[model samples]
Target: MHELAIADSIVQIADRHANGRRVTKVQLKVGHLRQVVPSALAFSFELVAQGTSVEGAELEMEEVPVTGSCRGCGVESRLKEFPLQCRACGSDDLRVLEGEELFVESLEMEEV
Candidate 1:
């Protein structure tokens, strides 16, 4: 699964930022469009984190709903369904405001 690669990257980032500190939590912002299966990602994270500071750390994911601003109608809305269209007007010219992001926001480290 691609989650393995994603988790590997996460561990690498966390380990790098942690600077040898023990990580207790890893906060993430995951967009709906990413289609990440939470369970799989968690499992993958655990597997990838073996022997690293991130091991046993909690993986907290915040699901970012798909939101966009319509260029035609100048309306901002949450796009629920794909063939992503503007809610105000039937326009495909949407500038995505949020969602479609996979970021490691922060990490909580153990006491030094």
Candidate 2:
């Protein structure tokens, strides 16, 4: 699964920042549009981090809901998956105000 690669990447970045410190947890802000399966990502994280500095590190994910603004109705609302139409007016002319992100928010680390 691609989540394995993604988890590996996260471990690499965390390892660089941890600098010999043990990682306790990693927080990620994931958007709905990112389409990442949280369970798969967590499983992959545990598998890839085995015997590493981050072994047993917890993977915490915060889901960001899809919010979009429709030009036709001037209304902002949650977006349904795919087709990306506005919920208020059913218009395709929608601009996303949030969602579509995948980034590390924080890393819990031991103090030396």
Index of the highest-lDDT prediction = 1
Residue 29, model 2: lDDT of 91
| 97: Cα error in model 1, Å | 1.5
Please list the C-alpha lDDT of all candidates, in the order they appear: 0.92, 0.88
Q: How far is candidate 1 from the true structure (C-alpha RMSD, Å)?
A: 1.3
Instruction: List the lowest-lDDT window of 10 residues for candidate 1.
Output: 79-88
lDDT of 1: 0.92
**Candidate 2 local Cα displacement, residue 31, angstroms:** 0.5
Instruction: Residues 1-112, candidate 1: write the lDDT tens digits.
Output: 8889989999999999999999999999998888899999999999999999899999999989999999998999897678788888889999998889999999999999
**lDDT by residue for model 2 (56-77), tens:** 9999999998888999998998
User: Which ranges of candidate 1 are over 4 A from the true structure?
Assistant: none
In candidate 2, stretches whose alpha carbon ends up further than 4 angstroms from where it belongs are: none
Q: All candidates' TM-scores?
A: 0.91, 0.88
